[model samples]
Every structure is written in C-alpha cells, then in structure tokens.
Target chain A: MTLLEIMVVGVLGLAGVGMYGLLISRNLIKIVVSLQVLVKGAMLALIAAGYASGHINLAQSMAVTVIVADTVVAVIGLALAIQVRRRFGTLDVKELATLQK
Target chain B: MLNAILVVGAVVGALQAIRAKRLLVSALWLAGCSAMVSILFYAMDAREMAVIELSVGAGLVTVLFVFAISIAGEDTSDVRAFVPKPLAWLLVLISIGLLGWMIIPTIGAPIPGVEPSFSEILWQQRGLDVIVQSGLMFAGIVGLLGLLADAKVPAKETAAQKQAATSIPPPPKALSQSPAIREEAHV
Candidate 1:
C-alpha cells in the first residue's frame, strides 16, 4: 500500500476504536477521551483530503478550524462531566439516568 | 516507512486509551496518540498544524482531562456498557467498512502546484469560517464560566443541609408549670 493508503487505514482504525470506546465506556471522562480520539481521526482525514486535492493550504485552514471546535467540545464535555459528578455523586452514565425519575 | 510506523503507533495509543482501566491512564494514552498525530501532520508538510496540534491537542487537552479526572474522581470501578461488547464491536466494524468503501474510491493523486501561502488562503478564502470559530470560542468560554459558577455550591454545605434535615429536633418545653402537671409530677 502507498503512504496515502496507510494514512487512510490509520484514520479509519482510529475512528473505529473511538466509536467502540464511546459505545462501551461508562465513565464520563472515558467518554470524553473517546470523543477526542474521534475528532483526531476527523482532523487527519481533513488533512489527507487536502493533500489529495492539491489544496493543502485550504485543508490545513479547515483542520485548524476543526481543532478549535474540538477544543471547545472537549472543554464543555469535561465541565459537564465535573458538574454531573458533583450533582449525582457518580460518574457512571447508567447511574446518572436515575435522575429522570 | 516512517509514516506507517507513526500511524501504527497512533492506532495503538488510541486502543490503549480506550482499554486502560484508570481514567488517568486513558488520558495519558490519549496524549501519546495526539503526539503521534502531531508528528504525522509535520511529516505531511503541515508544520503550523503540527505545532498547534502538539500544543493544543497533546498539551492543553491532556491537562484539561487530568484536571477533570482529579475533580470528578478516578472512577476505577468496572461498569457495564449500555450495549453488549460483541454488538458494539460488530457495529463499529460495519461502520468502518462502509466508510472505507465510500471514501477509498474518491482519493486521487495530489496534483502538484505552486501552493499559496497559508495566511492567504485562511484570510482571503476562509475568513468567514475564522470569524465564526472565534465566536464559538467566546461562547464556549462564557458557557464554561456558567457551569463553574453553577457548581460552586460546596459539597460540604449540601451534606450539612441533608444532615440537618434528617436529624430529630428536641421537643419544646411548656411555658410555666400548670397545677395539674405539678400535682401529677408529685404523685
């Protein structure tokens, strides 16, 4: 396989692992970690797409935008996790559902 | 060859991040993965992005995760997943397969060109996106402040309130002793 193929595989693998992590993890912090992984895969894909299209500059700019957005997501998710733990006394998503009743 | 190695390292790091028992360990693995991704970006000729990813993805984000873990507790206990493990794995595999099939055909050899400067593309072509991103950042800062302010009620205070509410109160004493009460006491 070529270098581009390798990068594509890496992107797919990372995204898959991230999704699996999100699906299986119960801890809020772990969920955040998975989300970070997922976003990294997306960033890689953006850059790769740019390289393919001979628009590296455009791609890099978009990647930068994604990075900023991702940071905001991570910060907000962490903040929400902290608040959930404080209010509910458990970090488990399953336990947090008890609040509905 | 180096790119392949870096990609493998990144994937492994991500796997470890997901599988680690402790939240802190998972966070550390995520940082390692981010570091590898930054190096990959540098190799791909996106130097500015590499630097930003190194600092923001590996550095700032990891610090944030650590801070959050410290405040929220490690949460080391093994909890059951909402979906069964086998089902989750199958779903992920199917999704990845579909994505790869759809995307692989579109990839083509990169056409060489006299590339424009990064700043030119960002400022001239993507100016609107940058402005929107700035707004998003400001909003995120404001939202984070709100969350922190809302969470400022001390845990100890809530616990104290609960204790006070649950504790039995002493019975009130009668004002001036009545004659019948005094006689009954004497008897």
Candidate 2:
C-alpha cells in the first residue's frame, strides 16, 4: 500500500477505536481520552490530505490552530470533569446520572 | 516499511488505551499512541506538525489527563452493559473497512491547485487566521485560569501573610531604592 493508503487506513482505524472507547467507557477521563483519539485521527487526515494535495503550509497552519483549540478544550473539559467529580463523588456516568443536583 | 510500522503501532496503542483497565494506564497508552502519530507525521514530511503533535498531543494532553485523573481519584466500576461489546467491535470493524475501501482508490490522484510556497501561503493568505488563532489561544488561557481559580486563597489573609504582603513596598518605591536606585527610579 502507498503511504497515503496506509495513513488513510490508520486514520479510519483510529477513529473506529475512539468511537468504540467513547461508546463503552464509563469513566469521564476515558471519555476525554477517546475524544482526543478521535481528534488526532481527524488531524492526521487533514495533514495527510494536505500533503497529497501539495498545500503543506495551509495544512500545517490549520493543524496548529486545531492543536491549540484541542488543548484548550481538553483543559476546560478536564477542569469541568474534576469539578463534577468533586461535587458528585464519582466519575462513572451511571452514578452521575442518578446523582441529584 | 517504517510507515506501516508506525501506523500499526499507533493503532495498537490507541486500542490498548481504550481497553486498559486503569485510567492512568489508559492515559499513558494514549501518549504512546500520540508519539506514534507524531512519528508518522514526520515520516510524511510534515515536520512542523510532528513537533506540534509531540508537544501538545503527547506532552500537554497526557499531563492534563493525569492531573484530571488524580483529582477525580476513584476506582471506576466496570460497566458491562454500557454498550454491547460485540456490537461495538463489529461497528468499529465495519466502519474502518468501509473507509479504507473508499479512500484507497484516491491514493496518488493528482490535485490541481495554484502551488504557492508554504511560507507565503501562511503569511499572506492565512495571516488573519493565524492572528485569530492566537487570540483563541489567549482566550483559552484566560478561560482556563478563570475556571481553575482556587477560591481558597483567603479573602482574609493570615496576619503573617498580610504582614509579608504589606512589608513589600509598592513597585515605584522599590524601584526608587535602586541606581541601582536611579535605574529603578526611571521605571
């Protein structure tokens, strides 16, 4: 397979794995992890497509923006998750759903 | 050969991360996956992206996950019924297979575009985007500071801390003490 093909397969596989994680995981941290995995797959695809199309700079800049946004989102999400855990006393979604207030 | 290895390694690491029992273990595996992805980006001749992925995805994201896990410390009870495992696996396989099948034919297809230097494209065409992105990052930093601000800093300072705080002269007065005093006084 060509490098592009390999990357495409890798991206798709990573997305699939991330989705599986998202569906099955109960822990909030794991959920975040799964989401990151999914985002990484999308970033990979973006750069790979850019490379193939000969617009490397456009892709790089876009990827940088994405990385920054991703970091911010992750930080904010973790902070929120920590707050949830502190208030609810558990990270499990099932427990969280049943938690009053 | 190296490309295939990196891709497989990344995919395996991601799978392991999703499957690992302990949250910490899962997070570390995610880091490993990110490292592999960075390597793949490097191999694809996107060196800048590789470094960014290494620093942000592997480094910063992992640290954030660890900190969150530490704060949310608890043994998560495994839920067997959250989603049916077999169905999930089947969906994963099918989706991957379908996407791979669709994209493989597009490999090596030539794309037509006005080929400008990457630097020019970044600085000229997308300059505004870069500025906005910088603003976004700054906003993110400010928002995070607000979100994680510790409320326990005490509206009422302890006497010793208050004394320490007051004992320190204002910047203008402190600056005046330098010429040491002269150099300080200018500020």
Candidate 3:
C-alpha cells in the first residue's frame, strides 16, 4: 500500500479503537477521552486527504479550527463532568442514570 | 519507516487508553496518542496542524482531563467496562471492515484543486468560516463560565442569606410562622 493508503488505514484503525472505547467505557471521563481519540483520527484523515491533493494550507487551517473547537468542547465537557460529580457524587454513568430516575 | 512507527505507536496508545483501569493512566495514554498523531501530521507535511495538535490536543487537553479526574475522584472499579471484551473486539473488527469498504475505492483518484495560497485561503476564501469559528470559540468560553457559575452557590442566594436579621426574623420563629414550614414543622 502507498503511504497515503497506509495512513488512511491507520486513521481508520485509530478511530475504530476509539469507537470501541466509546462503546465499552462506563466512566464519563473515559467516554470523553474516547471522543478525543476519535477526533484525532478524523483530524489525521483530514490532513491526509488535503496532503494527497497538495492543499496543505487549506488542511492546516481546517485542522487548526478543529483543534480550537475540540479544545473548547473538551473543556466544556470536563467542566460539565466535574459538575455532575459534585451533584451526583460519582462518575459512573450507570449510577448517574439511577440518580436521574 | 517513521510513518509506520508513528502509526503503530498511536494505535498502541489509543488501545492502552481504552484498557487502562485508572482514569489518570488512561488520560496519559491519550496524551501519548495525541503526541504520536501530531508527529504523524508533521510527517505528512501538515506542520501547522502538527504544532496545534501538539499544544492543544496533548498539552491543554491532558491538563483538562487531569483536572476533571481530580474533581470527579479517581476511577472506582478495576472492571467496569460497559460491554464485554469480546463484543468490543467484534465491534472494532466490523468498523475496520466498513472503513476498508469506504476508503479503498477512493485511493489514487484525483481530487479537484484549490489554487489559492495559504494566506489567501485563510483570509479570503475561508474568511466566513474563520469568523464563525471565532464566534463559536467565544460561545464556548461563555458556556464554560456559565457552567462553572451554575455549579457554585448562586450570588443571589448568598446575599439573601446575609439579609438583616431584624427584617428576616429569627430562624426558629420564621420556620414556625410560614404556612409552608408550619405544616411541615409538625410541632
């Protein structure tokens, strides 16, 4: 496989790992980490696609925007998670579900 | 060779993060994964993105995760995954198959070009996107602040609690005086 093809496969594999984490992790924080892994894979794929087309700058700008957005989202999500812990006293999603009921 | 190594390292880190029993260990693994991916971006000639990923993804995001872990308390159980390990592996295999089906056909196919230079693309062609992104970032800051604020004891509640004792009446008598409290008082 070409380098681009390899990178694409790698991206997909990384995303797959992330999907597994997202599906199987019971901790809210773990779920957030899984989402970050998934974002990393998508960012890599975006860079690879732009590199293939020789639009490195366009890809870089988009990646930068994504990074900024991801940072904001992660911070907000973490803050929310902390709030949840304070309100519910546990980070377990199952426990939180029970609390909601 | 370097690309392959980086990809493998990234994959390992991601997997380790998922399997780690402690939340802190998992977060560090995620940082490692981000670092490896940033290196891969650099290898792919996306230098600016590599830098941004290294800083924001590895640095800031890790710090945030650590803070969250500290606030939320550490992982409680060593074995609390949402699904069985075999089922998770099966899901990953299915995802890999789907990805292969989706990406294989597009390889080596020529994509249309965008002729503008970096600055031109950022400032001219994508000006609107940049503006919108900035607005979204501002909203994120506001949202974080709002969430933090809501988590605290509201200022109004504290101020009301500090009201003059003469105007508010003593606590014991006030409890007996209010109809809502009187019914619940059972005295």
Candidate 4:
C-alpha cells in the first residue's frame, strides 16, 4: 500500500471519530466543535484522494468548495449558539432537547 | 517519514478535539488537524489545495469557531451523550464496506489514462458545476457579512445582571457552573 492510501484511511478514521463525537455530545459548543472536526476530516479525506492522484486542479477546487460550505455552516451554527445563550442561559443540547420536548 | 508524521498528527488532533472539555483547546486541536491535512495535501502534490486547507481551515475557520464558542458561553453541564450499541456496530460494518469499495475503484483504476484527462473534464464537462460552486461561495461570504452587520453585544448586561450589579443581588449559587453568566456580570 502506498503512503497516500494510509493517509486516506487515517483521514476516514478521523472523520468517523468526529462524527461519533458530534452524535453523542450534548453540549451545544462541543457539538459545534465536533462538527468542525467532522468538516476537517471530510475535507482531508477528499483532498487526500486528490493528492494521491498528483493532480492539483480538481483537488484544490474541491477543498475550496468544502471550506466555503463549512464557513456557511459555521456561521449558522454561531447564530444558533448566540440565540441559545440568550434564550436559555445555557448551550447544552440536552437542555435544548428538553426545552423543545 | 512525512506521511507517517501527518497521519500521526491528524490522529492526535482528532482525539484532542473530541476529548478536550475546554472549547478553546478544542479549537486549537481543530487547527492542528487542519494543519496536518494541509501538509498531507502537499505530500500528495496538490500544493494549491494545501494552501487553501491551511489558510481557510486553520486560520479563518478556527477563529470563527473560537468566537462562536465564546459567545455561546458555558453553563452547559446538562448536556449528555448516548449511543446505542447496535447502531455503533452497524456504523462499523458500513464504514468498512465503504472503505473497501471506494479504495478499490480509486486505486485500481489506471492512473495516467484514467486521471490524466481529469483537467480537461474539469473544465469542459464540469465547467457549470465549478461556476455554480463559486457562486455558492460568494453567497456564503455575503451571508456572513450580513451577520456581522446585525450583531449587538447585548449592552454588556441583561436586566437580571443589572439588578445584581446595582442591588444586593442574588447569591452566587452557580458561579463555577455558569461562567457565561459571570461573564455578563463582569462585562
């Protein structure tokens, strides 16, 4: 197996871990953070595939697209975070779930 | 040696982001993961991608996360996490299958023949996709600007906080548990 293959596998593992953390965490901030980690891992896996091919055009372009999408998600998450802070005095996802329930 | 380093760093960073209780520390770890991925990009010869990954992922996004975390405040001990055992096992099996399927086609394909023409495909067949993607990026930037335009810091104090600041105030029954609230008091 090539070094690039290992990297791709490792990145996949990292992405999985990030997703798991995000899924299980109830803290609003941690959920947001886990999401960030998820984005990072996803980007890495995609870009690693591009790199393994030794091609610049597609890989770089893919990274740009991913980053832009992530930025939008991050902004919306922040807005929600602020709203949660003001309305409930806490950002715990558990509390938010309770409130919703 | 280089790929090994990048892989290790990425693994460490991932663990840190998951485990770190402090939001700032999590952000720091997030940056580390971003940096590792950037370096991995370079190793794969996509220099342009490496630069974008570092600059955007580590620099801009990490700062954005830190800012959001600070604004959200911390009295969030009520949060909980639970994962069903059956679901986790299902995830493991699916991921393994995905790995086998994706890795095989990606690597087993002819490199020079299959991939050498990718640039032409990117420009010709995928041209519209690229343009639409760029438009999406522009829309995101504009949305972020709109958010920055309407932000108010809440006058550094709420009514409850002001009452506490002025009069005898409520006892600090939850100072340690509620740093975000204490932040309002100080502000």
Candidate 5:
C-alpha cells in the first residue's frame, strides 16, 4: 500500500477507537478525551478525502469549517464541565446514574 | 523530520492524557496531542486543517479544559489503578483488531489526491452534512442549558420558611408604642 493511504487508514482506525473509548468511559473527563480522538479522526478524514480529490477547494473548505466548529464545541464542553463540578463535586459519570432529575 | 517529531509528540501526549494524575495535566496533554496532530496535518499539506485544529483543538479546547480544571480542582483517586484489568485487556484486543481491519481495507483503495476544495462537496453535494453539523451544535447548546439548570442549588426548607415568612406580623409603629410605654410607667 502507498504511504499516504497508510496514514489515512491509521488516522481513521485510531480515531474510531478513540471515539468508542470515549463512549464507554464512566469518567466525564475521559469521555471528553475520547471526544478529542473523534474530532482528530474526523479532521484527518476530511484532510485525507481532500487529498484524494486533488486540488479541490471544496474539501479544504470543509476541513476549515470542522476545525472552527470543534473549537466552539470544546468551549461549550468546558462550560459544562465547570457546571458539573459545581453541582456534583466530581467528574464521575457514574454519579449521574443516581440522579433523579 | 517534522512527521517524526509530530508522531513522537502524539505518543507522549497520549501517554500524558492516559497516565497523568491531575485532570489539568491530562487536559493539557490532550491539547498537546491536538497540536501535534495539527502539525501532522501541515506536514501532510493540509494547511486549512492544521489551522483549524490548532485553533479549536489546542486553543479553544484547552481554554475550556482550564475552566474545568479550575472548577474541579484535583482528583484524588488512585491514578495508577484506573481502568480495570478486563477493560484494559479488552481495549488492547479491540484496538489490535480495529487496526488490522483498517489497514487491510486501505491496502486496495486509490491513493488520496491533494485537493484544496473539499468544502465544495459539503455545501454543494453533501448538503446534509451541514444540517447534521448544525443539529450537533444545537444539541450541545441544549446540553449546556441542561448543565446550567443542573448546577442550581435547590432552595432548602422551602414550605416552612415561606409559611413562617408569610405569617410574621409587621412591627408595631413608634406612635403606637409611645402609649404603651406611658401606661407601663403609670402602672
């Protein structure tokens, strides 16, 4: 296989693993970390796809949008984490299971 | 040379996020990983991607993480003993399987081209992705609202406090008190 394809595949594979890990984790912080993996994976995929299209502006544009949106999302996540800590005193998702409302 | 540096950095960042004791340190490590990944993008000739990752992944995300760490302080859990044995083994096995699957299929696909216009596909061809991205943004907003409400401390002793507050009589006027004072003096 070509070296380029190998990198794309590695990015995709690891990104999926990172996302899956994020989904199953009981810790809120780990979940966020997993989300980082997923975001990175998506970014890589966009870049890989762009590279595939060869000099297309459309793919590049999408990658730019993804990065900006990622920053916005991460900011919102931080806000939520702050709120969670204030109310729960911990970042454990397991505590959420016991919550009534 | 740059790729090697980025790859090594990625490994170190991953380890820090995984093994670091403090959530602050872990968040910082994740941001570092994001920076390395962005550098990798630049090396791969994805300039726009590198720009976005640096801004969002490392810049905005790290700020959010800092806010979280400030809110959370330190976690005193046994840092070393996290992730049970079964789970760790499962993660390892699953990772191996996934790597194998991804590499195998990629062996036959056409090599990627360096296109500068991937955004065209999203807006022009795959318009649905925009809708999905918007939906995701909306969902996150809703989640934030939920967090705000969740963080609120419920007022304690509500019914009794309200009842007592409502039942209490207004204080006697000074004019009314003067007569009572004179009567007591006379007695």
Candidate 6:
C-alpha cells in the first residue's frame, strides 16, 4: 500500500478504536481518553488531506486550530468529570442520569 | 518505512490507552499515542503542529488526566457499558467500514506546487481562526473556573452530616433556656 493508503487505514483504525471505547467505556476518564484518540485521528487526517492536496501550510494551520480546540475540550471534560465525582461520588456515566429525574 | 512504523505505533498506543485496566495506565498510554502522533506529524512535514502536539497533547493533557484521575479515584467497578460488548464492537466495525469505503477512493498523490510559508498562511489567510481559537481558550478557562467554584458536598457526605445532626440530642431544656430569664426570676 502507498503512504496515503497507509495513513488512511491508520486514521480509520484510530477512529474505530476511539468510537468503540466511547461506546463501551463507563468511566468518565475513559470517555475523555476516547475523545483524545478520535481527535488525534482527525488531526492526522487533516494533515494527510493537506499533503494530498498540496496545501501543507493550510493543513498545518488547521491542525493547529484543532489542537487548540481539542485542548480546551479535554480540559473542560476533565473538569466536568472531577466535579461529577465530587458531587456524585461515582464516575459511572449511567448514575449521572439520575439527575434527569 | 518510518511512516508505516509511526502509524502502527500510534494505533497500538491508542488501543492500549483504551484497553488498560487502570485509569492512570490508560492516561500514560494516551500520552504515548500522542507522542507517536507528533512524530507522525513531523514525518508529514508539519513540524509546527508536531511541536504543539508534543507539548500540549502529550505533555499538558497527560498531566491533567493524571491529576483528575488521582482526585477522582480509580474505583471503576460500578461503570458498565451502555450497550452490550458484542453490539458495540459490531457498530464500530460497521462505521469504520462505511467511512473507509467513502474516504479511501478520494485520496491521491500530493501535487507539488509553490506554496506560501506556514506563517504567511496562518497570519494572512487564517488570521480569524487564530483569534477564534484564543477566544475558545478563554472560554475554556472560564468554564473550568465555574465548574470548580460550584463545588458541593458529596451526596453521601451531606446525607451523613444530616443524619448525624438529627441524631444528636438537644441540649437540656433548662440549660437551653436563657440565663438572663433565670436570674430575673430569682430576683
């Protein structure tokens, strides 16, 4: 397989792992980890796309944007997770649904 | 060959991050994955992004995860997947297959061309994105402050305190009465 093909496969594999983790993991920290995995794949894909289109500069800039946004997301998610643990004493996502009632 | 190795390493690290039993171990695996991805970014000629990913993604984020995990504790027994294990795996596989089918055909060799430098593109063409990302960072900081400031006693502790308060006997009625009233009555 070509480099591009390998990258594409890697992207898909990473996304798949992330999605599966999101679906099955009950720990809030695990969920955030899954999100990190997914965003990494997206970053790779952006760079790969840029490389393919001969706009490496634009792609790199966009990847930087993604990095900034992703860091914020991760910070906020972990903060929320911490708050949840303090208030609820459990990290189980299922138990969080009790708030709905 | 190096590109292929980096890609494989990243995928393996991601897998380990998700599959690890301990949250701290998972976080360490995530850091490894991030580091591999940064190297991959370097291989792709996105050196600037590679540096940022290495610093923020691999370094800062891992510290934050570890801190949060330490505070939250690692009691994960109550956690259970929303869906059954087999069904979740099936769904993920199906999604990957569909996405691969749609995306793989469009990829082609990068066309060589004269392009502006990274700084020029970032400053001239994508200036707005930089400003917006800064705003997002500010918002994240404010949100974290809000979350931390809104702390409440845990439900279990609150309940326990309440029960303890109620179980305590009230002061003796005579002692509870005002001392001034007793002195006035004596006069």
> Which predicted model would earn the best lDDT?
1
Q: What is the C-alpha lDDT of each candidate?
A: 0.90, 0.84, 0.84, 0.72, 0.66, 0.89
The best-first sequence of candidates by TM-score reads: 1, 6, 3, 2, 4, 5
Task: For all candidates, state DockQ relative to the true structure.
Answer: 0.66, 0.57, 0.62, 0.33, 0.32, 0.69
Ranking by lDDT: 1, 6, 3, 2, 4, 5
Q: Write the per-residue lDDT of candidate 5 for residues A1-101, one digit (tens) a residue.
A: 44355456546554645645564556666667767766676666666655554543565667766765765566576666666767677766666678843
Model 1 RMSD in Å is: 10.0
For the predicted complex of model 4, DockQ is 0.33
Give the local distance difference test score of model 1.
0.90
Mark the 10 consecutive residues where model 3 chain A has the least summed lDDT. Answer: A92-101
Candidate with the larger lDDT of 4 and 6: 6
Q: Candidate 4, residue A87: CA error in Å?
A: 1.8
CA RMSD of all predictions: 10.0, 10.5, 9.1, 16.1, 8.4, 8.4
Reference contact recovery of candidate 6: 0.91
Residue A27 lDDT in candidate 4: 69
- Give the per-residue Cα lDDT of candidate 5 at B65: 76
Candidate 4 TM-score versus the reference = 0.73
lDDT tens readout by residue for model 5, B1-187: 5465566567557656755667788888888888888877776677766777788778877877777677667664652324665676577567757765764464343446543245566577668877877787787778766765644567687897889888977667885579877798789
Error of 1 at B24 (Å): 0.7
Clashing residue pairs, candidate 3? none
- C-alpha lDDT of residue A66 in model 4: 76
TM-score of the B chain in each candidate versus the native B chain: 0.78, 0.70, 0.75, 0.62, 0.69, 0.76
Chain A of candidate 1: what's the TM-score? 0.94
